[model samples]
Target chain A: MNGDDRWDDDARAAYQLPIEGEEQARDRAILRLRRESAKRRTGMGAWWVDPDGLRMRPALAAVCVLAVLVIGAWSGAGWMASRGVRAPRPSIATLPSGSTAVTFVFRAPGATRVSLVGDFNGWDPEATPLARATTGEIWIAQVPLEHGLHAYAFVIDGRDWAPDPSAPLAPVATFGRRNSLLVVGEDQAL
Target chain B: MRRLLALALASSLLAPGRASGDESEEARLRARLKPELATPVIEVVRSAAAQGLPTAPLVARALEGASRQAGDEAILEAVRGYAAGLAAARRALGSTARAAELDAGAGALMAGVPEDSLASLKRARPSGSLVIPLVVLSDFVARGVPVANASNAVLAATRAGAADPALLRMRERIDERILRGEAPTGASREGLRELLMKTPGTPKERGSREPRERRQP
Candidate 1:
């Protein structure tokens, strides 16, 4: 009932980490470490690692399911990666200068990798990779652009510089391949 | 062995050029076409040649129609119209223009681009092949941009010395606008404003002011 010092410094320190509270805290800490170690040794998080829990038929079924899941995830990732990303702005926004955005699409169904390389991105294939659309054969990417003309081409499977079929030709044949033109923010009458 | 290998390589390289054989393109068109379509398609081809216009395009147009299994009457009309447009293009582009330019110009004409605008584009460049400009112009019209705006916008750029690359860039930007569901006219206007900023003396009217011709932005 002596409220002035609230329980004594020794009692307050008792609840603190144990260098101050010693034997009891030390014993509890050892018990927690042992429990964690035993749990990890049993691999309870992965039931298959515990042999008694595994039955022959269920084990085979689980393995098959795991394989299916992995293959499905891999294929699904390949499909999603192929679709790249298209910014869905249903309206043309008057964005600030240096804030224009455009999407590029290339329809190469069999290609494993597609990248956008252009003057804007220093013609680096690694700079902009396209992802495949899950439902379609097209590969696509949306890139922000500054207001000006930029020339580009799609590198299919890291080679085969293919110009966009819907884009205008840059007409300059760099390395015997024509580049495509992307005019970001301006319009020419024609 | 080396001589034999070199001769084989030479012949293989030459193979595609001779794929059509020694016959004229129209003759090939006739051979490949149905009986009803052959005569009129040939007439269009021959008439285009008589006018000093490229006949291959007309033949190709007919053959393309045939390949698509179009009706004979429709094929004939398309061939005739394509040939007439080629003639118009040749007239506007002058006798020195190339076959590719003529073909693309015809496409522009078919897409409702005015003949005089083609001529104006020719006058703007006045020296190089106009194939790309014509193609881009056709593309603009195909994308549903108003013909006059397309013509003027392209002409404005061409007048400012925009080449194939610049023209294509302009087109891609406008196309992005169209893809955003902007009306072709609105798309053209917004895109033109962007282009005008790059071109010197393009009357940029902010707020409610109307765009005055040839004024500095």
Candidate 2:
């Protein structure tokens, strides 16, 4: 009984030492692999190529903000155009020499063309063509006018005569149609 | 030969200097008008200019006719009528009247307002520009206000010390009232009443409110 028991114990001990050494070697190899993987993740290889690495640099942030604003403005203008809203009131800026810069805005949604025909422009429809705005319904023309009374009308598509709905009607209907009246006072908007 | 030379010298002496503005205006007329129609129209404009009246209205009238596809005769008549109106306006508004006043005055006259009303307006607003009062007067007439009623309303407003803004406001109110289905005359009368009430220093008593002539400067 003593001999058999002693031999079994010695054999078990001899096997346990190699097993423990193998496990230690395996653990060290595993740790080396983990450290190499971590180095690759944080290294220059990932820094330049990874999108997350760009995280809000000033140039990129500014570009993003500008892109958002441009998209917003474009959409807003398109919405305004679809609604057929009237353009804003005519703007008048007085020059240093007391001359007036009169911005004439007309809303003609479906018209292909619009022109300003007035006494100041010799009543020639082609003399002052109004430009269509991005809003699509409005046509605008700027005129430098002297300080006096001006009689004007809008010619639409070169055939239809339209008076300014915003201005006073002229007292006389010389051509069997009433024109609009504008009186430019000193430093005054139409 | 001596007689011919003398006649040529006399002709040269008598010819008026053609201003660059006049040339440009003539060129515009020619360019805008047909060949046969241009000559008579130019003569009318020149005559009006020679008389110290504003020729722009005359030229504008001709061009308006052309733009409207009016007949040549109609165009000529329009220009001549406008020129006559300008002359009448000058006489009524006096030589001191500015180009704007004359233009407005001409428009008022063409709208069936009596020349005397223009004269009265000049007297009422002697120091101020009469453009607004005249334009408002013309607008009232155009809106179907009887010429006399429009004249009286504007005259009263002017004599009540209403400035251009006040007069414009009165016009806007009248227009709104007319748009709301009120009779033009009643609208004008009520509009005038509202203005008089709002006017500073205007007597509240119906009897105390003097006639326009009595209040004139």
Best by TM-score: 2
Model 1 ranges with Cα > 4 A deviation: A1-190, B1-22, B199-217
Query: Over the stretch A1-190, how does candidate 1's per-residue lDDT look in tens digits?
Result: 4765666765777777447568888899999999976776677455566655545688899999999999999897666445432322433344566556676767786889998877556456788998877745678787776554455678888766777666654422323455554444434211
Tell me how each candidate scores on DockQ against the true complex. Answer: 0.04, 0.45
- Candidate 2 segments whose C-alpha is farther than 4 A from its true place: A1-90, B1-18, B206-217
Instruction: Estimate the overall C-alpha local distance difference test score of candidate 2.
Output: 0.82
Per-residue accuracy of model 1 over B1-217 as CA lDDT, tens digit each: 9999999999998876544442467567767687777877777766666777866656655554544356777778777787777788888899898776776777678767778888888888998767666766656676777778777767777776665666666777898788779998777666666666665554444312334322421
Instruction: Give lDDT per model, in order.
Output: 0.66, 0.82
Q: What is the C-alpha local distance difference test score of candidate 1?
A: 0.66
TM-score, candidate 2, is 0.71
A73-124 per-residue lDDT for model 2 (tens digits): 9898666544332232346766677667777777787899999999888888
